[model samples]
Target: MRPIYRNLAGLIAFLGVWEAAVRLGLINDQYVPPASVVLTRTVELLGQEDFLRDVIASMLAWAIAMLAAIGIAVPAGLLLGSLPGLRTATTAIVEFLRPIPSVALIPLAILVIGGGPESKIALAIYASVWPILYNTIYAFTEIDPLLIDTARSCGAKRGRVLASVALPHAAPFVFTGIRMSAAVALILVVSTEFIAGASTGIGRFILDATSGGGRMDLVLAGTIVAGLLGYLVNDGLERLGGRLFRWHAATTTEAV
Candidate 1:
């Protein structure tokens, strides 16, 4: 209760400062509206049917893309990680593709997938898969060799060794990758919606606000909603990871 109150106080203070700055003309209200105006616009947007639909559409795209990324990247990463030669052979290709910005691929995606949900989801998948793959590979490679040797000496089959030894050790890294991918998924989702044009999502809301007669307040409001959604998703992922990877918490405490 104390922590919650403290956080609320801090947020209030920040908003008060923002409002003061804008009202005093210390900041350009035309470009950066007051916190009060933004908040008002946010409330108005909440009641808007089209805006609500856009939020739902963006969330649906993010969820589908994330699931697809996890399903594809995890198994591929595990296989490559278990096989040193395969990991080595694919290293260059993976490195090359991983750094390619998802935004850059929007044009190609639009052309191929069309300017719709498909393009957004495809872009999200492209942006997200690398984190899971890289983390899975890192997790597998970093496992203590002694455990592998012990499992082998116990007459454990390859599958048994992987199940008992590798998976447990790598689970934390896998989740970490997933958490990272969530952020990527959100970024790509919004970028695709924005660049694709006339897309029915928060990005479209932002576009409409910006272009529809200098509605800076609406733009700020839309941006605030996007930021809140991102923060909520990230917090949810963190909580989920903590629950699924209790061993990670134990290990951290032990190390400290």
Candidate 2:
């Protein structure tokens, strides 16, 4: 079967097991509602205007953050990857900053940027930049020396070689990083909304559900929506990448 069919089959099997377990009293339905109940709530949420607004808010922040990360990381990666000395010079700082969790920065972001969409956007940008930056740098550094030499031998300037040879070679790898970054940005946006008590987003919706008399079905429903959102984003990006990078030679993990 196709991957989508296989995925649906697996999900159905799991949900069947879950529903059976709950019905048989193997698991408590009070805390963890049956799959049917959660799915019903999920369907209801899809029709709710308030929930859709939250989704839109989250997507808006995620998009902004992803765009900002690409803008900042791509050029920085190009410059650093092109210049060995610059990469070496900044290596220590990059190492130090890269390991810090984005969630840990949430409080500081709220204090500095205020507890609003800006705070979520800023944090998501920070969280998402590393993958794209590293991928871009890797792309440039991995360019074939022979290709660079050929370009130079043909009297091509550094700019000409970068634009013509290096960029096309690196586009696939850079796009892979973007795929990775997009997922990370979405997580950060939702988490920021949940933790910072933002007025909108799926995380906030989940949080509200939990706070409003322990609505377990609603909580699980929101969680299911988040998972679905992530699946769609990654799958869409993968299909787009496949179409755009058909000429990319390597059939490997990095391509996806």
Candidate 3:
């Protein structure tokens, strides 16, 4: 079967198991709630203006941060990757900074940029930048040496060689990096919203629901919506990437 059909089948089986477990008292219904109840609440939330606004807010922040990360990281990566000296010089600092958890910087972000979208955007950018930057630099490093030499032998200028050889070679890796960054960006956006307690976003909604009362159903519903959003975004990016880079997919399949 196609991957989509397989995914749907797995999801249905999981939900059936979840509902059965809830009904059979294998798990605490008060805390977990049935999958059907959560799905119903999710639909109800879709109809609410406030819930939609929250989703828009989170997605908006995520998009802005991801764009900013790409804009800043891609060019920087190309430049640094082209210059071995610069890349080597920065390796220690990059290694030091990259492993630091984005959440660890939330308090600093709150103090520096204040709360709400600004802080979340800053955090997401920090969190998402590494994947793209590293992937971009790696792409350049992995470029076939013979391709560059062939381009140069054809009397191609430095810029022409980069445009024709380096960039095309790196595009697939860049897209893969972007897909990875998009997922991380969403996670950071929602996590910042939860920790920073922004006025809107699904994470904020979940946080409020839990704090206001033990509204586990509503919380689970919001969690489900967040999960579905992530799945859709990743799936859409994957399809787009496949369309844009058919060669990459074929090569990957052969390698596998």
Candidate 4:
């Protein structure tokens, strides 16, 4: 069977088991609604303006954070990766900051940026920057030194060499990094919204649905929507990546 069919089959089987477990009284239906109920609610939520708004708000924040991370990380990565001295100089600070959890900084973010979009964006940016920056640095390492030397020998300036040589060679790794950061950005967006209790977002919607409402179905439905959104984003980026870098795709297939 095709991979898509296998994935569908797995999903069906898992939902069936979940439904069975709830119906059989093996699990508390009040706490964990049946798959059918959650699926139905998820479908119903499609028509709800409030739910859609929350989704859009979350996506907007996610997009903003991801773009900001890319903007900052790419340039910084290029600079640091191109210059071994700068990379070495910043290694200690990068190591220190990279390991700090974004979630742990929520209180500080809230204090600094306040309890809304600004704080959420701050957290998401923090969470998403590292992967892209590191990947870009790694991409620079994989570049052929001979190619760079050849470009310089041809009287190409540093800026010209970077724009014409380094970036093209690094494009694949850079895209890979962006793709990875996309997922992380989404996760952080939702998490920040949920934790920071932002006025608008899917995370806030989920939080509201679960708090003292006994709305297990709505909660599960929101969760399903979030998961589906993440899947779609990742799949879309993957397809875009494959299309944008045919050489990378060919190289990967050959390796496989």
Best by lDDT: 3
- lDDT by residue (tens digit), candidate 1, 1-256: 9998999999999999999999999999999999998999999999999999999999999999999999999999999999999999998999899899889999999999899799999999989999999999998978988999999999998999999999998888988899899989998998889888846999988988878997999988988888899989988989888888887887775421
Cα error, residue 103 of model 2, in Å, equals: 1.6
| Model 1: ten consecutive residues of lowest lDDT | 247-256
CA lDDT, candidate 3, residue 14: 99
Off by over 4 Å in 4: 149-157, 252-256
| TM-score, model 1 to reference | 0.93
For model 3, which pairs clash? none
Candidate 3 TM-score over all chains jointly: 0.96
Off by over 4 Å in 2: 249-256
Which scores greater on TM-score, model 2 or model 4? Answer: 2
Write model 4 residue lDDT over 7-87, tens digit each, in one string.
Answer: 999999999999999999999999998999999999999899999999999999989999999999999999998999999
What's the alpha carbon RMSD for model 4? 1.9
Give me the displacement of residue 247 in model 4, in angstroms: 0.3
lDDT, each prediction: 0.91, 0.90, 0.91, 0.90
Look at candidate 2 and give me any clashing residue pairs: none
Query: lDDT score of model 1?
Result: 0.91
Per-residue lDDT, model 4, residue 21, is: 100
Question: On residues 125-204, what C-alpha lDDT tens digit does candidate 3 reach at each position?
Answer: 99989999998999899888898999999999899999999998888888888999898989988888998899999889
Better of 1 and 4 by TM-score: 4
Q: What C-alpha lDDT does candidate 4 achieve relative to the native structure? A: 0.90
- When sorted by lDDT, best at the front, the candidate numbers are 3, 1, 2, 4
Clashing pairs in 4: none
